[model samples]
Target: MTKKTVPVKPHRRSTPSPTPRPNPNKPKPGPKTVPVKPHRRKPPK
Candidate 1:
């Protein structure tokens, strides 16, 4: 039987990848600007 050699293939990148969008499942980092605080006032004696 004769031995055969396989040819090596070259690696190539097509184009630059686009920027990824923010994930919707993850919560955003920052305090809310709403003026509806619940723990701001205390009960009267």
Candidate 2:
């Protein structure tokens, strides 16, 4: 009777990546605003 031998392989595990964090001190970019004139009105009939 012959005995069969099984080969064992090494298991490799992947490491978790680090998460990116936002800066709290920096100000957020906003849309541009246009200035309006106060005397810019329509004339009455």
Best by lDDT: 1
Which tens-of-lDDT digit does each residue in 1-45 have in candidate 1?
Answer: 887897866578655667655786777666865576678866688
Q: How many angstroms is residue 25 displaced in model 1 relative to the true structure, after the best TM-score fit?
A: 0.9
Q: Mind giving the per-residue lDDT tens digits that candidate 2 earns over 1-45?
A: 897786865576555556744776776665644455568656678
Which pairs of residues clash in candidate 1, taking residues 3 or more apart in a chain or in different chains?
none
* Candidate 1 overall lDDT versus native: 0.70
In every candidate, how many clashes are there? 0, 0
Q: How much lDDT does each candidate structure score?
A: 0.70, 0.63
Backbone clashes counted, model 2: 0
Error of 1 at 15 (Å): 22
* Deviation (Å) of 20 in candidate 1: 5.8
- Tell me how far the alpha carbon of residue 20 in candidate 2 is from the true structure, in angstroms, after superposition: 8.7
Estimate candidate 2's alpha-carbon lDDT, on a 0 to 1 scale.
0.63
